[model samples]
Target: MSRYSKGISLLENLLFFWCGLSLILSIGGDNLVIPSWLQVAGRMHPLMLHFPIVLLLLAIALLWMKEESWRGFGKNLLLIGANFTGITVVAGLLLASEDYEGDALAWHKWLGVVSLGFSVFIYFFLDQVANLFRLAGSGLAVLILLTGHFGANLTHGEDFLFGPLMPKEDKMIALEEAEVFRDLVQPIFESKCIACHKEGKIKGELRMDHLEGLQKGGKSGPFILAGNLDESLLIQRIHLPMENEEHMPPKNKLQLTEEEIEILRLWVMSGASFEQKVMELPQEEPLFQLASNKFTTEKTYSFAAADEDEVKELNNFFRKVKPIFPGSPALEVAYFGASTFDASSLSDLKNIKEQVVKINLNRMPLENVDLSFLSDFQNLEEAQLNFTGLKSGQLEGLSKIQSLKSLAVSGNPFGEEGLENLKKLTQLKRLFIWQSGISESGREELKKALSTVQIDFGFDDKGIIYPLNSPKIDFDKVMFQGTTEVKITHPISSVEIRYTLDGTEPDSINSPVYKEAISLTKTSQIRAKAFAKGWIGSEETKTLLFREGMKPKSYKLTDEPHKSYKAKGATTLFDGVKGKANHTSGEWLGYTDSPLEIEIFLEKDQKPKAVELSLLLHEGAYIFPPETVEIWTGNAGTWSKVTIPPTPQSTKTEEIRYGLLAFDLPQGSFDQVKIKLKPIGKLPSWHQGAGSKGWVFVDEIVLN
Candidate 1:
């Protein structure tokens, strides 16, 4: 070959080799990383990509002409097109190696590879295969358009083109119209979780686009467990520390806010129902407030942030100053440790008066003279003076705080006349006057004046008619082998106890009055209620009496009771005495993290009709009713489950009451009766301490 021809052939061979390498790298470049300097060249792929489009189209146009000269020039143009295609594909591969993956990346990758391969084929064989070269050129042109479209999508977002043209909807929704799952919860997943967990992009094999997908769960397990938040992997991952490997969004992506996390936890705790509405939740519930805040558009404040140094100086041991939310300029100043509070504490906050939005002086010893200092805080949105010594006229200067939304002066000496000063605060939404001198008539008049405000005068217990307390049973032993005398007593001297032997409730007019101890002959449910001359009747109290079963001779427990609530011994379970309202009274036995198993050895084999177990359910104390209870009649080796009572629904924190779980026994009796009480493995999601283990308290167990 001639020297000039050899040089041209060598360049062609090198170009073909470069195109092959680019194709290989593009296919497997998802896990690769390039050096920092190469990343700059990688970023230039967008600019370099245009060269192949222009050159390839020009070559195709030249090939389309019928002249011999155009055909000759087209072959040379194809060589140039091949060179630019190699450069574009290689640059795209470099960019792909920088941690990009998804449907857009996949489509762009394979198309660029195909275009490069076809360009190299035409560059070498255009003269030998002219018809095939024309077909490849047309195919290359189509690939170029598709490759560019997907590349644009990867650079910008999927909706970049259509996003601006789409009609924008209001971000906030009315609470009454908002759906709990679809409207409130799903939006959070779309923003923070759907990027990696949507269809075609399941990072952990978890897809969150549809309700069915979330219900089915991922590789690890189900994302949610309805009322159980602790068992839900979705909640566990979100609560993980940011530095932990399992944290959601992987630390590199956007993290869920505290409010968002709380909302998700609450929604999952609330049975994760897709059909429930925001208004369906209790008005006093925290979830209701969170939902209201989310759906209601808040007004923007134009006030500038307080100086950092001034805010720092204002904070002391007695007074604390902080932002209402992270990165927000609005400030909340509260006084603590009443002994350290004085008139001078108010002066420290004067520098940041304009920035302060909330002030709490609860339980402080401020006098009426100190009320003047609050006049400067014109931007205050909430103020609490509960239990303060401020009198009627002292609050006149507070009327200047026009932005106040809530004011609490409960337990103060401020009387009915003091409410007139609050009339000037037109923006006030709530006012509290519990334990103050404000009468019911005065509260009604104030409510009429401030029509929009919710005035709370506390629970009404006034007038000659007082509410009666539930009657108490005076007898210590409720269950006896033979007939026993039962007596009921009332706290007030004027009150009388009405009695009934059947399971029906007692009323004042028909039920017979109890003058002394009443004898019981058999198993009976005795119900009683207190009646007073000028008072509302108390709630009915009932107790079951078993007259035929003897006390157990010996007993054993599978799980030891918690030390704090352990009674004398396992015999405590059979003790005839009932526990008090307080679970911590040492009368009840508490079990945590495990179920309570008690095996009682009866004195002799006697036919027992039923078994009753008394329990306490106090959600605030993290005490929940037993999830399940099983009773067995046979001895250790031949024991059989006689019955399992249905588990009660978990109660909310607002309910603090006591109840009994009764299980019906079989007709036959045995020497031993085994009881198994299983506590909730983890507190329900609605609980504030939701993922922790719960407690079960039992005071007495009776067999009849």
Candidate 2:
């Protein structure tokens, strides 16, 4: 035999061997133990299969070419394509033994084997079946197309091939009729999860394709803890770092987005109800804003954005005017600092009347005349004038804005006359009259006139006294050289804010009522609450008042913080700005594997009586307070260690908390101080990441 003929014989023998090996592995199914080395080869099936597909297509085209001379070259191409096809079939069988199943995978696997069989058969009989050569080539081409179609579906997701041509179901569910789980939560799973956790391929033995399987769970536990996100196995897996072996979607697949994860959190927080509708929850619920995007078609405005200079000039510390979303032309204007809100605040917004689509004047001292300014905003779709001191017959001024769709007049004393005028706004779809002066009968009359409107007459009193929310405390600065003015405000006009300087809780009658901003000169623990005539008292809110003492001239960290959370370096500790409770807010310096050893130099003449280290506690994220805090005072390289009490145990739950660890110092004049904080070596037994390293996040250090 010729040299080329011998090489061709050897390749054909290898092809036969691969075809048999693929058959045996396919029969082995789940019983086969694929080694690590073989699994790596199997993963190359996706990349290698494409080469054989192109080779076969070209070989088939050459074989059927009208020219006779190319038929000889086509015979050699067919043999080479058939050899690679056999190799691909073997790799595919190995891949199938992994976490792959469902109808799409099954069809793709069988059709791939069939396509390889056809290529091998046609190449051997090319000369014997000359008349049938074209017929067999056509059949093999059809098989390749079908095999590729199913393979694409397996890799890309269901309906990937014909999804664009298929008739789509309308997904725009009305807010009143949208079910929480069916309309919102389930779709999230189908899109991001469910590939490996479906019926046939049950990774971790967990099936998330249906409700019952989710509740039943798999090897770990229940999919969700119902009202608890910390204990839920599914949430725990998702919150794991992307590089973690236990992270969901295997890090290689499409991972869940932040918005999708938030929807899951809302679902679990609201009892993971399967029967709850969107309208059944409170109208002001944060979930409604998220669900609105999913359930209804997003509104688009036709007007162009306002001039950048005009928008920038209008924005002040108290007033904000910006687009509803990024790059959107529609503007949502809001007025803050209610004490400075004047009548001109509404009139000043007319500079961008064409772009102003939403206005929020909630809790402002707005009068009836101020409502007339809204008439010129030709594109206004939403008006939040709740608690604006509007009275009866004032809403008539808003009827002229023909584009108004949502009107929130809640907390106003607008009775039948005010609601009667709202009937003239034919475009109005939602009317918020909660706690307004309108009676039930008057609301019925208006509802009949605007039959399609969704009227939210918030929480029917029904003689039930719901607890008020805690008063919001606003201060210019947390650390101050002189006295700082602390202002406490509540949204409702009738609600009273009572506060105390001591650590004791505030009561309705015993505590001093907050009429104006309170002046503070020293360190004090302030606890405040809200009370109304017919409502239960609100929970007490606590905060610390710090009088700045010796300021640090400079500071340095002996140990580096984690790369991801190293806030502006050591300067963050004495920048005079405190971080929020969220540890990821760039203001915090996070340490995971090392102790925080910081040395600070105070002014020469200043002597601090005590030192406070501000830290965050969020057990859900494995951020715990320091296990031990050591303080040493020194000057000119001479140091004296100060004895400190054992670090107090953290009283935090799943929620984020900002707390201080204060240490009193002995009477001495020390210019240099060293603080050492050791993070928890291992998480507590009750934590989700037990036996793993914990994190310590410190934002600022106060010397008083």
Instruction: Judging by lDDT against the true structure, name the best candidate.
Output: 2
TM-scores for every predicted model: 0.43, 0.44
* Clash count of each predicted structure: 0, 0
Question: How well is each residue in 367-454 modelled by candidate 2, as lDDT tens digits?
Answer: 6554676788888989998888887566776888888889988888877767657677667888887888778898788788889889
Question: Which residue pairs in candidate 2 have backbone atoms (N, alpha carbon, C) closer than 3 angstroms, thus clashing?
Answer: none
Number of the top candidate by TM-score? 2
Query: For each candidate, what is the lDDT?
Result: 0.76, 0.80
Q: Judge candidate 1 at residue 461 and give its lDDT.
A: 60
Candidate 2 root-mean-square deviation in Å: 13.5
Q: After superposition, how far is residue 515 of candidate 2 from its true place, in Å?
A: 19
